[model samples]
Target: MESHERIQAACDFLLQSPPGEINDVLNDVRNIISDDELLQEGIVPALKRYNLAQFITVDVPETNHQSIISEAARLSTGSEDEESQERWLDPRSKKSFVFDHIALEASDPQPFEPNEDFETFRVALEKASLNYLLAHFHDGVSSAFSNQTTPNQFILQVVANKYNPTNFWSGRWRSEYIVDLNDHTIKGTILVNVHYYEQGNVQLSTTHSISIALPPAIVTASPESAGTKILALIETEEGKYQNSLNDTYHEMSEKTFKSLRRALPMTRSKLDWEKVLGYKLGAELSSSKGAFTSGFS
Candidate 1:
């Protein structure tokens, strides 16, 4: 496949995986940018864009290569340029030679001090860094999703209420599961819910119940797994645009979806959905990890 397609696939895969799997992401990056352009253009540019090159400090002073090349070619076919600008060897490989030049240029590199205010340069650098990091982060996320090795299940729940006695209300539900390939262990799940209002007066509403159960291994692994399971159960049953009892709800929960759009490095950082639900239901778990109940007053 083309580079863009490969990148896209990797991203879709990462949505199901974790970002901490760096090796897998790097491999996917290699596939997206082959050896020819990968090193010079793709990898180099990506690193620079992400400010990694700055951190690595790849700059150094120029070296006099005239005598070194002359000595190496005492009886060889290689020739040195007048000022040794064109080609030179220092017992380092050809790649190292290029690397040295890049480092030299980067080291003490000229800053864009075009008589602008201090904040200007700071803002520009921040924007550029953000752009590069975002692109690389996206690619990394995709690669992580594709390398998932866990098995999972999804469950959804929908709940709705109407204040008036005669009006109709709607609710939508959705859920997703990332399944592990090895040992059929569940990795994670994303859940969503939505509520819609109608014009007429109505009171009382129905709730669609859903229950998802992961294997014992997955449930006991970490809190993230537990959160994913809870999300799946709630998302499976959301509100329908309109309910005639037998009618299907094509719409899924979309509210607050973007709030959780940020990516985490691993499943262990997944939100504690149990605490959230517990607070919602007002359960009396005093000893619970009530992180989710802090500001819900």
Candidate 2:
């Protein structure tokens, strides 16, 4: 069948079928297309037309905490490269440390365009994934200490508070697409990991991973409303993390995680898939223009 015809058939099936038969109807659409690439391109838009984007599987499967820590450490110490380090001295400890922050984002500019195809979606997903990795290294000097020291004092406060035992901290933000076109569902994940150090040793680590299921209707819905719903889901996940950690850690980890939550931004901007899709391949994509803001100071 022609691509448009197949899409129309899928839409017609969805419109007439009951909720319980969604899976069967989706499977039939896959069978009719019989091409992974073509199905990914054509059927997805059809699903969106029918308000079924949520059923797509978009996610970031690999989130390596150890890698995040190692990259943050490398950036902080400037061992990997001196130019990458942003040095600062702690006021209380009088010790120099590096503060690095990274953000990862992915987008597609014309995801909803009639001519949008699997290649466009695949490119967007690949770009987002690369950003997820590069986010670990795209460090910037923290604003909190940017103006603290002059040529005379030469010392900058590292930790947010004087009483805190941690002398250094680093944070990374990541967002990616894990699209399973074969399954007829779309999904995404947002990750935030923060590490605290004292005397160059990690004292505490806190992480938040948010899984988002985008409904097909989202493609046609208001971007603002869609973003708000996604952020709400993220906040809900944050609450779950707090509850899960409540009984596990009664002291430092608990206290530090709570403080980190307060420091992080709770709101996010609307995601522009079209712009994200237009990014260059293998480039260090910046999330500053994406939905969420950097939570680390």
The numbered model that scores best in TM-score is 2
Off by over 4 Å in 1: 7-28, 31-35, 38-40, 52-54, 59-297
TM-score per prediction, in order, is 0.17, 0.25
lDDT of 1 by residue, 1-297 (tens): 776565545444433222123235556656655654533343433432222211112222243221111211112124433222232222111111322222323122111211122223223322332343254222111001112121232111111111221333332222222333234443332222222336543222333333334566545544444444433332333223224333432222233433556654476476677687866666555534475467563
User: Per-residue lDDT for 117-232 in model 2, tens only?
Assistant: 33333233323333332442342111111112121111110111112224355443333333332342334443343445545544333444444455666433443443344334
Error of 2 at 144 (Å): 26
Cα lDDT, all candidates: 0.31, 0.36
